[model samples]
Target: MANIQFRLQSSTKEKKPISVRFKVGRKTDVTANTGFSINEKDWTETNLPKKNNDVNKLLHKSLLKLQSFLEDRYNEALTDSTVIDKFWLSNQINECFERVEKKDTGILANHIQFIIDNANTRKVSGRNQIGISKSRVKGYETFKKIIEDYQKTAIKKQIHFLDINKTFVDKFTNWLINTRNYSKNYSGKQLDNLKTVCLDAEKLEIKTNPYIKQIEGFAESNEERFIVTLSFDELEQIRTCNKITNDAHLNARKWILIGCEIGQRASDLLNITKEDIRYKGGRMYLDVIQRKTKKSVTIGIINPYVVDIMKNEFPYKVSTQKLNEHIKKVCEIAEINEKVEGKKLNPEAKKNKPETMRKIQNFYPKWELITTHSFRRSFASNYYKKIPTAVLIQITGHSKESLFLNYINQREDKDANADLFMQFYERLNKDKEPGMTVIRNAQ
Candidate 1:
């Protein structure tokens, strides 16, 4: 006889996921996530909801429903020689609940799920199995949820690749902007990810709309948003500020100085230890692979400020949250009070709501706007025109110069080579009379 049971994974006072256990006779027991959670206090020792409230009652009903459905499915599969395992149990659970479509279903949402599930097997440029990061997988999950919501509210049905067309794009973008409160940039990113998925689907011989080739997402121009950067003088102020009496602030100050000097992202910069540092040809460097892009970057310790800071002692390792908080306070003490035009993420924004439109955009003092991100931007901004663009990009570990320029919020001057052109013109004119026409013999 087959039996099903439910249990909580932890005794924590907070909500915890319900674990589903399936057993057949003997030695066939398996445990899986029920994809449902309940508050610890509301759970009974008998592996059931206490039914103290309507929500718990509903939770109890859902578990009972799953048990009934799974029993029926198992009985049906017995005659068909279906293997009973965690995968089969998971598929059954998903089919019983629309958490995702059945594994057999080939729809827009299903393809996204496939990508999310098989992200680890994904390769870049057909070689290394450099999978997408966990955050990226979470991003895809969020986008999938958004798609599911859009289907329920607007499409009123499942979205298929064939159903993706000009009409769909128009309706989707409108719903994202007007109904979902997403900014143009946020909406554009979602559509862009959709296009990438569509392209990936095509490679798999999946049916898709031909118009997807022409499909494009709309976003406000980059020129509209301000790129925050600290001036050399401002960085110096933060670096030399003596008012930092607290130990936390002192550690963060050292990190801020090193961050701006090396121009590395927070994850890469913070995880660096003394063992990662290398000496080559009388220079110090930190060799690391960028957490986001997976690119190998060797950051040279060229700045005298960072060198001096590291000379006495290396900064203590701290969480990114603590580092950001301490740096903001350090900036305030340094009197970086100049109001700057910028937009920042709203920590107080409602969960599951997009931080868009006017909620995040505003002018605030330079100190208030400064964050770990400002380190790289300030590094790029300060050294942009001073150093050769190519050399700077190499140091910044950017794959492309154009992307490097855009990252630094710099536009290349169109007439940058005008002086060279003028010199060439003068040399050409100096070799002959101004009005003379010279012709070379054909060889």
Candidate 2:
């Protein structure tokens, strides 16, 4: 009895089905029935002749298909008894499809967040929630902490919009550079993440964003050019430490070295298993998904030396942070003596103190301001010097050329530049050539 019948509204003589319209629950959706959707509202007011047979038939079929699709989706949404879950799922799919129909916008961050959150609630609710894996829950905790910190900091700067204005964006850029001392590329990435969150918020009506301006760019940092990457000596130091030490702490050091070789984040490397590696095409490689970006990343292990070390250290399960600590210890043992950040231990700190104080006092290395992330940066820097930029970007999953270059550039290599210029002058003056003068090399 429902007026849910599909009818073709185009010319009856036209053999090709132009459009089909169906009515449902005070609303209508139309399709070309050619595997694409069209707005029925546009066709409904058309002045086409009513006696068009071909148009009528196509319209009827389209209505039926749309009705069926909606019915199925509706049924799926209601299969669960939880009203909140059903409403969330149904609304998200409907909104996404509606946006698609209108060709309104590109993939928004809020849409992705909706899907992820819905998946988590549906999959982990009830008794099963208690069984959530430690790794996944830990990742969620990390994500929560980041969001909390961002919100707290950004709110102080009046950046509460779901989508930020250009002014706030510029301020954030300055904050990262002048305040955080982040390199240009690093600051860009952090801002990019903020942009993603804003766009996601836009989709949820939490913010208004359709940033009219192009993303801001920054001048490249000269200091980045001088960053020293891990040399063969550092790798040897790590490998030797692993060979001599059999404690769990030492095993963590071994994994950290492997992490450096593969150029993976500590979190991603911590989750690695024997299954992630494959020996194919006469070479070995790791197939991994970056935890932060959820992007697929693959890395080849060409160095048989590092490969051997990984194989030797296999079958050990350790926390990523613990491995970081052990790497610092190993660095100290190797007389690398570079002060790296570690957790500060206040042996007498009361349990009643602020939770922040509970954090293991970070090991602040006097010579090197190092953290777990340095291993990843060191790996990228080491490879960029030895490999082509394009190949390195592919391995590291870096989308921006500037970022890829910045990863390898060291800031402390000012002396190297001076030395090069010195050599150039010396060459110019040699043998009294045309542009030659008496050149004295620096002692």
Q: What is candidate 2's lDDT per residue for 349-414, written digit by digit as tens?
A: 445332222224244552233346666777887775456556767666787667766566533443
* Local lDDT at 423 for model 1: 68
Best by lDDT: 1
**All models: lDDT?**
0.80, 0.53
Tens-digit lDDT track for model 1 on 96-187?
Answer: 77675456444788999999999887875444656887778888998899899898876555766765777777778888888876777888
What TM-score would each prediction reach against the true structure?
A: 0.67, 0.46
**Number of backbone-clashing residue pairs for each candidate, in the order shown:** 0, 28
Which clashing pairs does model 1 show?
Answer: none
- Model 1: worst 10 consecutive residues (lDDT sum): 350-359
